[model samples]
Target: MLSLLDVFTPAAPVWSVDDLIRYSGSPPSTCYRYLKVLCGAGFLARVANGSYVLGPRILELDRTIRLCDPVYVAGTSIAQHLTDSLGYSTLLCILFSDSVMCVQQARSRDAPPQLFNRGQRRPLIAGASAKAILAHLPLHQLRSIYAKNRKDIASGGLGSDWEHFKRALKQIRSDGYCMTVGEYNPGVMSIATGLFNRDGEVLGSLAMVAWAENSDITAFRTLTPEVVRAGQEISARIAATENMMDLPARAIG
Candidate 1:
């Protein structure tokens, strides 16, 4: 199921039979069978271009998960409130395998048309949201990711070498947040911080973004702490909920 599901991700949202076989490594005959069955089941749709994409059934499943996702449950209200108060766009993101995917966003009515990206995954080596989470990841996992994506990592300015890359992450870890101007989207700047659960496991990242031209150094100085505070608050709530879930039934009573 997951292998089939992976073919419709942010990078390859549409796929042909051959594309699926290449990515999924399933035999052509087996891939053909599943694609036909999936389209028939409404789990995928045969698009006009003869490629397959996720279908209505997948949307239904996504909605169900969103309604239950702790990140969405704990984040939207705060994200919306932050957007309203700060006059910027706020977003929640989580690790989707080797990258980070946007899960939720709230745009201030006063802000310019916000970046219309929700569900798009970005390389974890690039943006403030990804960096914040990347800084908190286990060192081994971070190194593993870097080893495979070194070219992207170097080009994106995390570092050109291992020592430089480690230093960059270490600085972010020490700062407890990441701030970048025009790194991902030119003319857009962002501040991000990590979220953690009860076991101190990295949950995701929370970020606020605004136009860089109008936002000077002073604006960054003002917004960074606010975004970081919101991230910490969300992490606390997630941790508290996790702890509650871990409690014995009799303990609750």
Candidate 2:
């Protein structure tokens, strides 16, 4: 069904049955069957010309994501402000199992870095954004992630062994942030810190990417305090939002 949606884009919003069949790489019968099901569910709209486009269901899902996603609600302004103030790009990543997903990115420039953007997903075993959240995750979860990705963990210099990985995480926790230079992108550096929810669970990571060629590694250290402050501010706001939503339920209980 989603394959049918992928057939339409901003430049070309409408697709005929042949277009859908071609783009979806499915047979005509299967494409028609899926299109019929999706149209019946209000996920696609059919025109008199036999072309189809996204229907109300996509809008409903988009609205739900905008309103219900905590990071988007609390971190957007903070990230945008930080990017504006710093003249650098900032990213907000959500913790999704062993993957760190770039759910929101706040950058002012017309030409942004091509690596991480909204909806980009990367492993939690590398980069400051991933490491920052990993540093704050519960012990059991961290252990499980490390157990599954031992080679990646070792390659990232986090650890070759369990004790070493634990120590790396401990240091990150003590410093209150994680810093990596030329780790993910050569001549590019990133600093990141964890965001927490109302219950103090690790919710996500906030990161800023800067060009190392322009800014020295030592200069990157200067960004730590403000970046951390922005992350904490977003975290607090999200916590308040969650707490308020839980308040009514608590009263009922």
Candidate 3:
């Protein structure tokens, strides 16, 4: 059931009943049963053209996550504070699968229009935010991603081969952050640091963006420490929240 729902994306927002059956490789009766269940549960809705789109229930769930999820709650405040203090647009990105999704954004008054917005997904090897998270992933996962996206990795200048790619990510880990210029978008610069869960698993990244014209290489370095600090603070807050949630109800109270 969840697999059917996963077929809907920004690029393919609607699906006909036939489309679902073809994609799922299920018989017509089974597909219809599943679709009926999903529609009844309000996770899918029939559109004017008889295709299905994600229903309003998804919006409700998104709102709940934005309000209650520890990473979103912590990232939102920290991103806004960084934008206000640093005068650059800030992005809070989360890693899911091989993509990084922007979950929170705070725009500075004078900053250039942001290339990424909330809910937009970018390749894991494309930008500073993605690289910051990618650098911390386990070796096995990193190897898998590199094997699948070797061309993109090379084109993005991350590395020409697997060994070089590992070296590049290692450098990011050593520095505690990633910085890039015109990587994802033309003439834009991004500096990002990784956010982690209580077990030190990579959760996402917090990044600040500025126009390259207004930001020099030397100036970009100065901002990395602040962004890295913000990332650490966000990770600490999420860990604290996780710890609280793990406590017994009576103990928490």
Candidate 4:
């Protein structure tokens, strides 16, 4: 039944009962019964044209998560502080399932239109924000991801083969951060470092972004330490808080 909600997305936010039935491959009677339960429970709402959209309960849940999730609370303050001090946009992104999702963003005055804004997910291949977390993932998980995306990994220039890919990520892991220019977003430079939990598991990445024209390549490298520091501070904050593991991050919308 919950799978029905997966059909609603930014590109197609409304679905009729007929559409749901066809998409779910469920009989009309089963679809109607599930929709009735979902609508009654406020997981979905019927529209004027008999289509349905996500209901207010989802908004309530989102609000609750932003307010109560330890990672979000800590990352929000850290992201805002970095943006204020660095004069660059700051993003806090998490590893949501296999994708990277931005959960918090603090934008500077000259910041470009965000390629992936808060609550939006992006692929795990091209950007510093994604690579920082990718480099820290457990090797078995990394191997699985690489096996599934060999072509994309090669296209992103990480490597053409699994061993090469592992070596590339190993280098980034040793460096403790990833820096990229115009790889994810044209004309933008991003430096990212991993955020970790109490158990030393990677939670996400903290990235600072600026226009390429505004930053000198050599000088930009200087800010890498600052971004790394912010990432560590956020990780420390997560560690200091009790029961953080119980509060798994809800980063995707």
Candidate 5:
């Protein structure tokens, strides 16, 4: 099943059983059975033209899981406050299992026309939010994430230079914030700080994104302290509610 999922990952949103079989290099009978089970389990849906796409069930499950995420539940007001204060778009994102998922977002009154709808999944190695989260991850886990998405990174969907990404993560770890320029979206600049839970475990990241022309890199650097403070404030709130201490020392690196 893991191999099958790996085979389908690149072809997601629009693929067929034949494509899956070809990618997996598996026999027709086995591939058909696997596809049938996946469809029956609501992992895939047959479109009007009989092509397979992701099903609503995956979304439904994703929603359910997100609802239970403490970071999503707690970060809404923080995001709103930050956006309101900074006049830039703010987003709350978490590493949802294997993918980084946006759970909440707030847009400033003068935010850009490009809408960042909730539930969007940006690349972990490219965008500020994902990079902030990735910065604190243990090295082995970071390697795994990079390996899993190597194809996309190599294809230029992520940053143009992989070495630059490595250097950026290192700087993020030292600086307590991550910044990006046109890494995720052209002409969009962003700064991000990672949020922690009661156990000091990285729960997610909070980010502010603005137009490249209007944002100054130095101004973005100045915003880092505020972003870190906000993240810590939110973390303390979660800790008070959960009544636990001693941050987990686990590192993805």
Candidate 6:
């Protein structure tokens, strides 16, 4: 059921009971019962055509969670600063168990037409923000995520240039930042760096996205340091939070 929540949350407004049943590997009757219960509890809603969409309750919960999210609280100012300084939209994203979830986003006064918003999800292999987080993930875990999301990769929807992607991740790990162009969206470019807690566990990534027409090598050079600094600042703030105090202990064990 929790898995259902994870799947549905990321895919809200576009999912159906059949998809849920297929994903969960549950019997039709069981899946139907679960969906009925979820709808009754205001977790899922039945649309006009019989498709299921996420209910208003989920939005209320998401709003509350976003407001209280430690990373979002810590990164909001930095994201705004980056947007103001770079004249590009900035985003803060965290890997929520199996998917990368946007927590906060700020658009520059000069943001491009294709700029994305908070709560958007991008493939882990398709964008700089996702690559930044992926670079910090343990090798085994990264491989596992790739294995699980292979279909998205193979369909050319996630920019899965296997060799190129792997090499880029290696470079990101070594350089402490990631950059992408025309991977997720054509004519869109981004640069990102990972944020970590005191224990060095990755907490999230901070990214700056701009139109390709305005983004050149010079722009990358200019934004790289600022992005890295913002990531480091957020990491330090997260490290100081009480919730992160046990991270090191858990890592050690």
Question: Model 6, stretches more than 4 Å misplaced?
Answer: 1-32, 46-53, 145-168, 244-253
After superposing candidate 5, which stretches have Cα over 4 Å from the reference? 2-14, 96-101, 109-123, 139-171, 216-220, 241-253
Compared with the true structure, what per-residue lDDT tens digits does model 6 show for residues 113-179? 7666677766566678887887777767766766776666556443365565466567888998887
lDDT for 189 (candidate 4): 84
TM-score of each: 0.82, 0.76, 0.86, 0.93, 0.70, 0.75
Ranking by lDDT: 4, 3, 2, 1, 6, 5
Instruction: Give the best candidate by TM-score.
Output: 4
The C-alpha stretches of model 1 lying farther than 4 A from their native spots are 1-28, 45-53, 110-116, 242-253
Per-residue lDDT for 209-234 in model 5, tens only?
88877777777667777778888777
The true-structure Cα RMSD of candidate 2 reads 5.8
- Which is the better candidate, 2 or 3, if ranked by lDDT? 3
Q: TM-score of model 4 relative to the true fold?
A: 0.93
lDDT of 1 by residue, 107-180 (tens): 75544354636778887788889898888777778778888889988978899988999999999999989887
With candidate 5 superimposed using the best TM-score fit, by how many Å does residue 89's alpha carbon deviate from the native? 0.5
For model 3 the local lDDT of residue 175 reads: 96
Point out the higher-scoring one by lDDT: 2 or 6. Answer: 2
Per-residue lDDT over 107-161 for candidate 4, one digit per residue giving the tens place of the 0 to 100 score: 9988866546888888888899999988888877887788888999998989999
Report the C-alpha lDDT of model 3 over 1-253, residue by residue, as the tens digit. 6799988998999999998999989899999999999899889999999999999888999998787766688789889998998788999988867789888888876676656888888888898999998999888888888888999999998899998999999999999999888898888889999988777888889999988777677786798889999999998998878432321101000
How much is the lDDT of residue 163 in candidate 6? 61
Instruction: Please list all clashing residue pairs in model 6, or write none if there are none.
Output: none
lDDT for position 232 in model 5: 77
lDDT of 2 by residue, 1-253 (tens): 5766755677898888887888888888988999999999889999999999889997888787678778778899999999898888899988875688897887646323554787677888889998998888767777788778899899899988999999999999999899998787777688999988787778788999887766667876798999999999988898888423321001000
Which residue window of length 10 is worst by lDDT in model 4? 244-253
